[model samples]
Target: MTDVRLAERPELPDRLPLPVVDNHCHLDIRRDDAPEVALRQVISEAASVGVDRLVQIGCDIGSARWTAAVVDEHPALLGGVAIHPNEVPRHEAAGDLDDVLDEIASLAQHPRIRVIGETGLDYYRTGPDGVAVQQESFRRHIALAKRLGLALQIHDRDAHDDVLRILVEEGAPERTVLHCYSGDMEMARECVRRGYYLSFAGTVTFRSAKDLRDALSVTPMEHLLVETDAPYLTPTPHRGRANAPYLVPHTVRAMAATLNTSVPQLCQALSDNSEHVYGPWS
Candidate 1:
């Protein structure tokens, strides 16, 4: 059974005229009791709506392993592996931080793993005490991504300056993405100037996200990406629901509206950007 606290599953939106990619999702964290069944349903439903593929993100050790395996079995998926910022404190305390990161570094070698990410700063939940370890982990992940020649997906939250500083200091990977980009217009321009990709999530569709929409307006289509970050950040009208990849059309449609373009136009741009960052899914 799905969690009762979450909003009910939403009806599917109309199929997109062109295919788009969900640049970030967590298939392993579906609310359904039978995850395998849920995963298949979401993927199939997403395809029917022209969301042809997903970049499954694994921001923890177990999910990283799961993501690595799941992508091998599913033609519609690629993988992103890392330890999340909040998890940094726990792992460091366990005294196996390096070991797990080494394991993640090994997992980066997997053919289906195309990204190292969701691995940047987050000061909102983590305190000042944990910032050093988090920064250390972030730097190492940046290095690992560069070493493996994979795209870097960052999870910046309330630590934008530090995140950008470290990226410049350590030298960001060739392909760097600010996943669920929460920065304002100036920050957006800075990211664009630095040639970093900004991936917007469902939050961008919310009425409360005026700043995000402003950032989107200035972002070039080629540098913009979209994601579900599913089971969280469910887009408007379905804002409180248990999100899935199938629901991406709603967000994409809203994004098109915000950019004052047709859905297909935005879809094509998003598809092109996804492929540019992660290479071909096919």
Candidate 2:
């Protein structure tokens, strides 16, 4: 959680030598710093620092609608829609799961909707009781991706093993992305071997994320992607502040340092991978 009292947003990073796409973000999220940072402002601020393209995620019903509509208006934004795993229990308990999944399926048909996700398992938040529905939901989302011929973006939390197991069980879509990947070296190797893309977020820049960096070490650049997962995992130096698309350069710089590669080289790779996974922003 960001310290809202620190109303000061960080200054823009020195622009990247090459522009890179923010593979995962939630511009619709309302944080205290700027409850709803104007969409125009979000795009402009990010562009000012070479973060020109953004893949906005709308993981719930309302935001999914917002995403479907908004993506049509912004050439810089491509979108993904899903019912997040943590949100699974609430709908299942209310018996609204079927209805919402129907809605997601319909909304996903929008021309600008390019991905089905921010889905998958998250054991850290939901306990054993919710596991069944979460797994069911994940399977459905994976099926939707394959049926629609769209990419899938996963949100695996403390549920890496189960996540991997289910992904293999369901037969993952061609361009599956483990968004904000937090798995270990061995799991990283396995995921890469299975041809999954691992997207590193601001969390990778943390001092305690040595394992996360190690995972990145083995993830080939072609399978590498960068993201903000914004209004959340704000990178180091800007940790306590509300995150946004503009802060992506910080994470990009950190990733380059960890990979022991030039910033330009990594930026080009991230940019290339984003397009490869989600297709062109245009």
Candidate 3:
């Protein structure tokens, strides 16, 4: 019964008018009790709903290793690797931060690894003493992305100002994306003005995310992106349920409605912008 419940997936929504990419997923992180969700099934389900491509982000060491090994096995998947900010202090305490980062750098060199992040400040969970080291990790990631010419995906939570300040200090990669962007109209404006991409997650579909919608409305189509952040931030109507890339349609429809644009239009923009940011998944 427990396995059955964990195996239950949200029913597939109507197919999208055009295909899009779920650009920031952590397929490597699964709940302890959840049944193993095969990568093939994840791809097929997502493709059936017109979310045909995905970019997996592996921010911690274990997931980073998983990403490097599995990314090439599936044509539908590309990947990003970095040390998550929340994990940085732990790595620092373990005295393996440098060694772990070295391993991440090596893994990032994989051709299928086209991104250098999901790395940035996460002030919500990380305490004050860890801030400096966390910021340093973020800077190192920024430099690594520039060095490799790969896209950079940031995971910022409750540290918008510091994240932006550090991005400016270190000079963000040419293709920098703020994954699961949670900032308001003002920060969105600044990010846009600085030529960064804002990737919306399921939270934008929530009723209380008027500020997120406002940010989305003003963001130019060229600079827009979308992600599931699966296994987290599942869209409304399906809130409290486990998220997967296939569930993207709910958020996409909400985004379309919020921007007052056609679903197909937004889907096309998402696809095109993803290619621009992470290159061909094939």
Best by lDDT: 2
Question: Which ten contiguous residues of candidate 2 have the minimum total lDDT?
Answer: 1-10
Q: What's each prediction's TM-score?
A: 0.96, 0.97, 0.96
- State in Å the error of residue 240, model 2: 0.6
Clashes of 3: 0
lDDT of 3 at 245: 93
Which 10 consecutive positions of candidate 3 have the poorest summed lDDT? 1-10
TM-score, predicted candidate 1 vs. hidden true structure: 0.96
How would you encode candidate 2's per-residue C-alpha lDDT over 92-195 as one tens digit per residue? 99999999999999999988899999899999989999999999999999999999999999999899888989988999999999999999999999999999
In terms of lDDT, the poorest run of 10 residues in model 1 is: 30-39
Cα displacement (angstroms), candidate 3, residue 242, comes to 0.5
lDDT of 1 by residue, 157-256 (tens): 9999999999999999889999989999999999999999999999998999999999999998889899999878989888877888888888888888
Per-residue lDDT for 83-195 in model 3, tens only?
99999999999999999999999999999999998899999998999999999999999999999999999989999999999998898889999999999999999999999
